[model samples]
Target chain A: MLLCGLTLLHALVSGSVPIPFATVLQLLGGQAADPAAGQLQTIILQLRLPRALAAMVTGGLLAMAGAYMQVLLRNPLADPYVLGVSGGAAIGALLALMLGLGSSLVSGGALFGALASMLLVFGLSHRHNNWYSEQLLLTGIVVATGWGALISFILAISPDQQLRGMLFWLMGDMSHSDTPTLEAMLLLVCVIISLPLATRLNLYAQGPMRAASLGVAVQPLQWTIFVIASIMTATAVQLAGAIGFIGLVIPHIMRRVVGADHRILIPASALGGAILLLLADTLARTVFTPMQLPTGVLTAMLGVPLFLYLLNKGRRT
Target chain B: MTVLSCQQLQLNVPGKTLVSGLDWDIEAGQFWLVIGRNGSGKTTLLQTLAGLRPAAGGEISLHSQPLQQYRRRQIAQRMAILFQHQESGFPITVQESALAGRHPHRGLWDWSDQDQHETVFSALQTMDLASVMQLPVDQLSGGERRRLELATLLIQDPELYLLDEPTNHLDLHHQISTLEHFSGLAAAPQHCVVMASHELNLGLRYCSHVLLLYGNGAWEAGRIDEVIDPERLERLYQHPMTVQPGSHGNIYLPA
Candidate 1:
């Protein structure tokens, strides 16, 4: 992890305006950047630093949320996308853009949409006495279809010039990040607020009946964890325009590597998710050199191969 | 004093009624062995009492509080259940799974050390299961999981213990050991243990009282001598079952 961080620092320092290690060190140590350090400090400290941090945090949050989703739904194949969280978030961000909200409403809007989807799914899935997994699956399909219709409606009525920006946003980008929301995302500290501590979440994974018998407040506890997961997933979607599989791919990879103790897996996954996304973003940004590709497309490109390999390995295990 | 009282309790499913319009009261510290054949209402009665399923009509009261008034967690703290059947394989360590019984006793913020650890530890040690503490639950041989679950139940430490076919999968040695262990639970004045089983001879030997569930929802709850009848069994279950004397002066079946 330290090596990865150091490598990233080195990469950031070597951007269009190159900064010396000594100047990077001085700036990190709380001293002002030397005039001799010039535009390099400006690029590294202001632009590259926030971008890198944002990628890492977003990736980490998505992965943890995805891991929680698979466990909560009790389906090995379940991911955030299957529950309509991703689709709702995408539709919300799309709508916000069409309204000329200009990115400020993106994260919270996505989070609100995710929560609405969750409530809808929960209400629909509840049966006479207990919840059935089949009902939940159907609800997800309904909500995702509804969100798709809304997105299409907004696009069909949008102006031609605005249409290009809307399409680009939907394709996903990290460039929408500003100084404030990124700072707010940092304050969210998903690990502290999420899963509502490791022990309860760990007990919950054993299935609802056992958990309830053991005295877990199953209904309230589940809702709390779900809300935290929704917030984290929404924040990630807003920052990176609904990037795919950071949640799904990273947790699966970590589960194969680390054991399933959520106490250990949660922290390990957060770090793993952050590091993997940072490297993926770095590769996306640098691979085409001067030409840029959307970080979301690159993530999917990287995720699919890794995901398939993990799937094959999972079958063997 | 009656610790559990039922007033006009009726358990009914969609098509037919299992047990209906029955009124009974069981005093504190009185153990019951409710015996019935397959398709009889023994399992249904127990599930209804445990609040897992709703009673079609009638009311049950525990310690003067209506059963419906107790939330799931409150009920969990007061009663524990051991299933007659369990899933064979689960991917977790015995210790990790056993600790789950402490689920109701803990607050969200912190896990109390003295209570949680002491409760789980004593439960494990009491069942002679400390040796297999770290073993994977799935890796344990067949009868071992039942013992582990027993430890979990003990950790729950509810005043009322409910068992459904508790001895179903055990070998002869384990069956006797389990029955004997249950017979020697906490001697508090209000503690009660209730189970349903086909092991009539064992039920006769250990249980303080018996509840016989028969055809057409015909029922009797009283002393074993009053309820166990050869002719009644022959007519109801349609099997020529017999009971004989055993070495401990308790009843046992030779055939």
Candidate 2:
């Protein structure tokens, strides 16, 4: 969390028009003494601060969701998008863009799409007196595949003028980072609600039947995890346009450090994911000087090798 | 008092019946061994009794209440089931896994209390897992994993235990000790044990009652002395068998 705070501060000051550390601190403390530094103050407080905070929260949300899904499904490859919420969101966002809608409308459509997907998975997986975990898993995978096809179809038919922006969103750009309040609230709420279920989630990692035998109320618990993870993923996708790698890799990395106790691993994953994405976003902003790469690209570039290194190191020991 | 009772319980697959019209009563302090050939629905019968599977046709009552009336957690507090094997791709320490058994007694989100910790500790010690409490369960051998699974059952401390193949992958000594421990648990007036095992002699030695499942949906449940014999054993397995009166119990062997 300390590193996350520091990274947020560094991101706030290291933008195109760099603000000195002292001025940044003064502005943060509600005292911008010099009238000459008005632009710097505006940039730091209004623009950079919200964007940086949004990046951190989005990263934390995605990682936490991924951790829950991995345990809930008992699959290491499970991620925030495993249930097709992201694919649904992407389809909605892309549809909005093809119709030349505003960014807010696009995000709203994305959230709507995600909700539809969640309901679809939930409804199809539930049958008369039988809520098998495998049924849910298979349903989610098929729904995600369906949404992926729709997203591709949208991309192919979109007009040239809107294609660049759509592609940036697809690759996960934070340049148009939405307001952070809703995302921040969701991040806090998800963490608070999931903290209690963390221990139960640990049992679930063994298998659903094992968890059921251990008194976990496995069906209800699995449903709760699916909803929480879906909400987190939807909120993050709406804010930052489907960032990757943090969700898939951060929980695995944190498991090695925190030893797979969901209580510690979930929170640690939140913080670690926040730091990682904050650093990646900052690097994305500054690496090419005047131009910027999509933050998702940088996350994968940085994450894949680091994750592989950790896995290899674990195997050696 | 009768702890578990099923009337006309029938277990079946899609096109065939495994066991039918089976009526049985399990009282407190009774240990029952359910024996059958492979594919004869021993696991299915145990699962149905544990409320893990639906019975084809019958009413199963726990503590005289309809089984479906109790919530999953309520049922868990009353009974624990040990599967033949547990597989996890994730890593969890032995102690942590054993402590998961306290879930029925602890509130949701609450950590294990001191009494719960002591229970898990003793369970670990009983299974000889005390020396490797901190080791990841994935690192344990097959026998060790089986013992650890038994430790989890011990930690659950439920009124009834439904164990299927409890002694699978265990060494001879561990198997004997584990069954003896189960019999000791079943000696209490308010507790009972129902195990499905292929080891006819061991079941004969430890269990007071037997439920032999013949392949053609036929079954007999009674005191071990009355229910198990050379004739029934041979009929159940569809093979010739020899029975000997051993010092401990009847020895069943294929002739």
Candidate 3:
């Protein structure tokens, strides 16, 4: 939490136009009054503050969704996008961009696409009143592949004028996010709701039969995790446009630090994810100065090496 | 008192009928060993009895109530099952794994209290795993994993235990001591055990009753002595059986 606060303050103070730490604090404290400080206030409050919160919320959401997905599929390699949710969202957002839809409508389209993909995977994998994890993984991967094909097809036919905007969204840009409040509320609600199921989730990670034997309603719990994770991934994609590595890597990192107890792992993953993304976004915007890099690129570049190192270290130990 | 009862129970795998028209009553203070050749539906019957799988035909009742009518948690609180195969997908401490046994008794948002911790600790000690409670389950040996499974089952402390190949992967000492522990548990009032096993000698020594599956929908259930003999054992295995008289009892061996 201290790290989160420090990261947030750093993000607020450092930007293309560096605002002094005192003025940033003054603006945050609701005391910026001078004409010069007004512009600084706008820069801090309107631009950097919302972006920081969005990064935090988006990061936290993706990480929690990843944690749930890993358990729900019983695969350590499972991530939020493994189910093709982002592919679906990408298709929807790209289509909205192609048709010149408003930004809000693009988000709505992305959400609709995500839901469609979720239902597709759910329907395909559910049979004989059983939702087998292997079946779900296979079906999700196939559907994601199909969505990927569609995404490429859409990109090939899109107009050149809107191509840059579409590409930025695809690479996960945060500059367009105007509403972090909804995403923040979602992150809060997900953490609140998921904590109660932490113990059950621990049993669930063992296997479905054992989990059932241990008193978990395995079927219902599986469905609940799937739905909650899909919504989280959808909202994160809607807010930040397919930021990738936070969801996949943050949970594993947190698991190493806090062990596999969901009671601790879940909250720790959320906080860790928030901090990592906040730092990543700060670097994404300020490192390049006037020319902003896509936040997802920075996450992947940083996350890949860290993940590989962890994997190698794990094998050694 | 009957702890679990099944009427005309049937179990089947895709192309084979394993057991059919089986009526069995597991009374309190009885240790019943399910004996059969491979694919004879011992595990299937145990799973069906535990309500882990649906019976092809018949009714399973726990304490005079229909098993289907009970909620999963309620059923879990009354009955526990240990599978032959155990795998941990994630790294977890032995203590955490054993603590999962308390899940059935705990409510949502209820934390494990001191009593549960003590219970888990004792179960770990009984399984000879107290020293390695902090070790990740994946790092444990096959025998240690089996013991961990037993410890978890011990912590569950249900009225009925349905264990499929409970002694698999266990060392000789652990196998004997674990069976002895289950025998003791079954000796207590309001507790019963049904375990599927391949060890006929151990079954004879520890089990009060025997359930023989013939792998073709035929079965015999009665007191161990009444249902087990050289001739029946030979027929059960479809091979010649030699019985060596030991000080404790007859040890049956394939000939």
Candidate 4:
């Protein structure tokens, strides 16, 4: 947690404008006295800080959502995208763009799309008191495939003028996300709701039958976790574009550090995810300065190899 | 006092009846061994009594109230079940897994406190799992995993225990030790233990009450001494069987 705060500070000070640490601190502390430093402070305060905060919130939400998804589905591979949630969100945003909708409306479209896919998967997987994980996974996989086809169709038909921006958004860019208050609030609410259910979530991961035997309200708990994860994924997709890998890998990594108790794992995953995405977003901004990359691209590029290495190492152990 | 009771309970699938028209009562300080051939619905009956599955047709009450009427946590506070199989989605240490048994007693926002830790610690020690407390369940041997399961049940400290194939993966020594532990629990006042098993000898030795599930929606329940008829045992399994009056208890063997 301390490391995440320090990294956030470094991110604020080391952006393109390179505002001095002292000026950044003064601005943060509401004590900037020099008029000459006002523009640099505005750039840091207005542009960089909010961007960093948004990335952290989005990343934290994604990781927590992924963790709970793994528990509810009882599948280690399950994530926010495993159920076509991100795909649905992307399709909604893309459809909005295809209609020349404004950016704000596009976010709403993404949230709507996410909820629709979530409901579809939930409704399809239901079968006479049996919410089998395999059935849910199969439903999610098919729905994701459907969303994938629609997203591709939309991309293929979109005008050339909007292609670059659309592609960047799909790849997940934090540059265009200006505000963080709503996402931050949502993130806070999610964390609070999730923390109380962590123990039940852990038991549920063993299986619905076992969870019920242990006295967990298995159906209600599964549904609650599912909705929360879907909402978090939708919020993340809205705040950033469609950042991946972090959601899937952050929980795995936190499990190694904090063990499998969800009480500790949830908070650890939240902080670890925030730090990871903030770092990835920073690299995305500064690595090729004149031409920034989408944050999701960098996360995947970095995450896949790291995840494989960890998995391989775990096997060896 | 009667802890659990069922009336006209019918457990069936789409076109098959496993057990039906059953009326049974379980009082405190009694151990019931559900014995039957494979596909005889022993597990189903146990699960139904645990409230994991609704009976096909019947009513069950826990302490004079409808079983379904009790909240899940309320049921958990009074009953704990050990499943036949368990899986983990993440790497969880044996100790951590056992600690999950405390969930029924905990408030949503409450973390395990000192007393809960002591309870888990003693359970681990009792099951001889203290040596591997930090090891993940996946890494443990089959016998170790079974013992871990027992350890988890021990910590739950429920008034009623429903175990499905509790002796599954245990060795001869562990089989006896685990059964002895359960016998001790069942001997205590206001406590009960129920298990589904194919091990007729073990059931004969330890169980005070016996329920025979005969696959075609037919069944019988009684005190073990009154129900251990060699002819009925032969009919239950569709084979001849020998009943030896051993020093400890009767032993059933195929004749």
Q: Of the candidates shown, which would achieve the greatest DockQ relative to the real structure?
A: 3
User: Which should have the higher DockQ, number 3 or number 4?
Assistant: 3
lDDT of 1 at B119: 73
**lDDT of model 3 at residue B22?**
94
- Name the regions of candidate 2 deviating beyond 4 angstroms: A118-153, B112-115
Q: How much of the real interface does each model capture, measured as fnat?
A: 0.37, 0.73, 0.84, 0.76
Model 1 lDDT tens row, B1-255? 676678888877678777877787767676789877787888888777777777888899988889889878788888887876663321568887888787666666654445576677778887667889888787776677878888888888787888888877667887888777777763457677888888877777778888877735677888776766677666656677666657754454423
TM-score of chain A of each: 0.84, 0.94, 0.97, 0.96
Q: Docking category for candidate 4? A: medium
Ranking by lDDT: 3, 4, 2, 1
Q: Which 10 consecutive residues of model 4 chain B have the lowest summed lDDT?
A: B108-117
Compute the lDDT of residue A200 as modeled in candidate 4.
86
User: What is the TM-score of each candidate's chain B when compared with the real chain B?
Assistant: 0.90, 0.96, 0.98, 0.97
Chain A TM-score (model 3): 0.97
The positional error of residue A102 in candidate 2, measured at the CA in angstroms, is: 0.9
Best by lDDT, which number?
3
Candidate 3: Cα lDDT at A69: 93
